[model samples]
Target: MTERSYNSLLSTGRIAGLELSNRVFLPAMDMNLCVEGEISDGEIAHYTARAAGGTAMVITGTGAVAWPVGATSRHQPAFSDDRFIPGIRRLADSVHAAGGRLCMQLCHHGKTASVDTADGRPQLVPSLLEGGADMSALRDNPMDELMRLATATHGKKATYKVADEDDLAWVVDQFAAAARRVKAAGVDAIEIHAAHGYLLSSFLSRTYNKRDDRWGGSIENRARLTCEVVRAVKATVGREYPVIVRVNGHEYGAADGLTAAETAEAAAMIQAAGADAIHVSANAHNPFADFTDGPLPNTVAAYREHTKTIKRAVTIPVVAVGRMLPEVADEMIAAGECDFVSMGRQLLADPDLVNKIRAGERRSVRPCINCYVCVEQNFFDGNPKCAVNPALCNEKVAVLTPIARAQHVVVIGGGPGGMEAARVAATRGAKVTLIEKGGRLGGTMWFSQLTTPANAMLVDWLTHEIERLDVDVLTNTVADVELVASLRPDVVIVATGARRGRPAIPGAEMPHVLTGDGLRAVITGDADADLGSIGGLGRVAVGVGRAIGLLNDADRIRRLSKVWMPVGRRVVVIGGGLVGLELAEYLAERGRLVTVLEEGKHLGLPMAMPRRWTAVRKAAEHGVTLVREATPVSISKVAVRYRVGGDEFEVRGDSVVIASEVCADTSFADQLAARGLNVKVVGDAANVGYIEGAMHSAHEVAREL
Candidate 1:
């Protein structure tokens, strides 16, 4: 890579007269640190951390410009009252002190706002349609009266009144007044939140805006309200102060909503009406709109593509957003796709992303793997967290301060958990030794990298971190009881991971049968070649005769390509978890007739909701047969028998893959405990769960140590 200076991104780009020291922008994210609509110290610290991290501008969470019905949540911050000016001023001052600019994203929540009114009253929208409100809350309510109750609960019965033409004008004036107050508070910029299915977004979208008046008909008419708000903010703050608008490049709904082309025209209008820049996003109301759950790694490309259109239509700079990796962001800027990159979850994942990049310490920079857990927490868990970087939300409490009593530590695994523990311990000034039986550090991640490219990033990150921390890495050196005792570390982290539990099913012990891990090892050419030859099996049929019986057709082909197969084309996958589903899809893609026999009622039930839904949808689209509420009873050379609904059925298949149980091996921990060794267990060896749990547990154990 040719070395080039980032002087432009590092220096402030002028929007009217407001100056930002850099182009790094922290997009809006609800910190959920507000108490009764008042910004708490936690919220202040959260924004302050971003500013301190050297962000050029910090955009506060959606601050309601309109009162009552326009607010999304009771706890969401508001700019409607001057009482917030003091708090806002404090935030601005903190940002300014950190050499950063501060901006508030003014918003209105339309129909999707929480219906819990201040005085126990109802909510309101442009239309009083039932089931039109955000359906997330309805999942917990009873089905019988859910829609009716939601409609009634969301009806404006108290402070919120249906907005008429005059009401719309009044709301516009309110935004202008709020802008004036924010400018007075020393905020460098003001952003209009016209995206994410908020009130402004609803008007821009054809689905929410049903009014036949000038604010509802065509795309231009629907966008009139947002344009007016932008113009009002510009008028109030004067042309010297920067004012940006965030808009959805595309709304994913059946309604003939604004397309990227239409959104570009609207953005141009907003710019022409005095907006300084346009920030592009997608998926208006979806809680996981950050593109974490999407299949693509370059989520920002969607926005970047649309920003190109908007850039052509407008004179102002376009800000692109999505799941933008730092490298991708730099490319976008280099290519002139967007003048600025608006990062939300990525910044939350690693506030020091830009700082690390500037220092040429890319390895030290944590990567956002696009897990929607951050958004999921905000929408459901009520607290956002980054899976990779545990110090995200609780930064004030989780800084990388040196341990008071650093000691020698031995991590007995080379997987994600062990690697994380070793890295953290080494960083905290501990003498760390990481022992792995394998030659490489990543363990199962080696297999994961083949399945998903983004997972490769984790391996790279872990490898880089391990090298940076200078931990002693002993590859192909398994730590035995004698060896561990001889090392005599102050602490022992047992992250030996889990072993594939071979169930006592028929033919499970057959030489033809292999475990999923065994298959992956063989497929990746990392398996001991001697093992396959020692069994006197010329070429093992690496197909359905595998453990967990979840090797899909594609995986079978990949495996068989290494060891030729004379078996039939039929296959049966026994598990419906993420692994099983993925295998099934792989098999079906290769023209193999695949049947997934899941013991659970729902396929991929163990996966997170967002991931499970996407997996299930993909499985369905791939024509993979699903036999839920079924368990495999037996597997034979020509056929597999399973029971579903108390009925036994034999499905003929060329091979059977077992995708079921995995057991954690903690015998090492027991032995160490018996020997009076200080030991902490982590990852699958402690609890069989997702990568998030494993990484989190390892980090926690290291922190405690």
Candidate 2:
């Protein structure tokens, strides 16, 4: 808790001649904040906010060394020409003015170049990679189809010719030129992107580099290209300037991927080539693998082992990244596993994470839930966005100034949206009162957290902020028109949330049938199990589950929730939406034979392609049966009957779950608006959406108030 205790992470350090105020660096993340090769005002504002948030160093994401030919994404920043220097210089000056150092990442997408954006030029690669599976390949499972679609649309495509000696020399020169441009821009340091299956990384790994020439086969030969680039960059930027190279510890998907041993050898070679530091990352070449930016749940801090291996191999400083929490990062530094710690999504979730940690207000720091919204947005050709932090990447809109006059505000429902509305309004000098019908502040989040425990962090943060900002929180208070009118509020925000609708199927009212929320409540002991005629065994399971819930350990409860849920040995879920599939997976993981029936053509239709792929894969891995185009007509004691493709089919399960749907219950909004009050609706109350939409709507309404 003391500054001295955080010496390893918060201590001042140097990279070559560049001095970093602290070891916390904002890892380079592609925000798609630029147009062509020029950094826009939005991009400058984005970096400026992070710098002002107390980042010691900020690495600008993926600036292309060669436009059109080597570009990865259409909107990635470009450093291919000297003409772009002025715009980057402005960014550098802004960050420096905020007392933070800036670094430019020079990249050549190489084999990863998008064919549509390559101006019909052949891509340069270490070797012409042989094609694997067909782009349109399909399998019996829905996950394969989703993965194929995600890969075809989201993954970059290119036609490549193996790089000859002349071509390699030209690329080296391009790297040198890009370094010079960055140096001229007044940037503090440069990072050579030799990782994440980029041009340089493609040469460093045997998976792509099969050439027999000076740059392929053995690890030494495969690493030659990276060494050359580092030398060229150092030479052009002058020996005193700092040069860092990013390398992957594991390619994740490649059959003979670059392992940690090979990666460490590559790092040693790069260090020997005069590089100042090694920025370690893992998982590329596989869309399904967690990329740290939006990591999979079980893979938290996934790349720490890689960083440790590389750090032990080389004398140069190593940067560790991979969904690292502040305390975890500090321990890693103190343990000498890595010299510097970088966080991408965490910084996006809370720009002031480093500042909060420094001030010993660690509880106030917002945690990234690893929902992958940030990475998903970028892959879909949108700017980076956070689910919990709606104002992220929109710093201008997030800026809050005090209102002219303080006014009374009423926030209905203590969900994320309502709580955020109260927090923002109260911060801007408003008398805020938040009313929750339940004893808890988090509304639906309390149920949702059972499926994903990470959400508890957001719930805790919002609750903490509401209390800290002095918002009058009234729990167990059923809000009504009469109660709201009695408060005499200037503005009323309805974030009362939505309700799940059970399907009108045969035998729906059977004691064994339950809504998704009802099942979760029974498992967590929020609802009485004895109310349902679920027999003695079910009652005992519910009792045990309630006991675990009383422990108040979200992670532990989430792990054993399925055991507490009083479902029969066989589980039948009547929907294939996000919640339905996740529930099916949870049940299947706990040894239940689960079948998911959905009328929709695909599962998780609203989710991003990559995330959907992961979800469907998870379902398959858990042996959860997914049946598309299936409409449930009846649920009996023995089985569930469904119509699929004009045929009736039945699957037996002990209990039927109506995970069918939810709709925005705007009854309160309609009622409050009828009273002639200045009313606003947010979160599920407005759109029946997720965290991102909820927070964005709340921020929008609160600012206006």
Runs in model 2 lying further than 4 Å from the true structure:
1-5, 115-118, 133-157, 288-298, 527-552, 559-564
- For candidate 1, the 10 contiguous residues with the lowest summed lDDT are 288-297
Error of 1 at 9 (Å): 4.0
Cα lDDT tens digits, model 1, 1-705, are 544456555656666676766677898888766665666677777888888887878898887775444666656677778887887787788778877788888877765566335346444455444353343422322343334333423444433345688868877898898898888888888899888776788788776677788888787888898989988888788877889899888765335756789898888788778898898876643433223322122344556677777777888888878777666777777777788887777788778767776776766767676555565554441557777878766776467668788688999988889999998888889999999987577877656644444566787798898898889999888788889989989999999888775557786655434467655644444432223521334234332234434332334435554344332368777787867887777667667688888887666654554555556666767888888788778777777788888789998776566677776779999999889999999998999765676789999999877
Clashing pairs in 2: none
Candidate 1 RMSD to the real structure: 5.2
Top model number, lDDT: 2
lDDT of 2 by residue, 86-169 (tens): 999999999999889999888888876763334666677887766653322122236644454344125434456788999889
Find the 10 residues in a row with the least total lDDT in model 2: 132-141
True-vs-predicted CA distance for residue 383, candidate 2, Å = 1.1
* Model 1 quality (TM-score): 0.87
TM-scores, all candidates, are 0.87, 0.94
- Report the Cα lDDT for candidate 1: 0.71
Model 1 ranges with Cα > 4 A deviation: 1-8, 116-124, 127-163, 253-255, 284-300, 510-513, 528-569
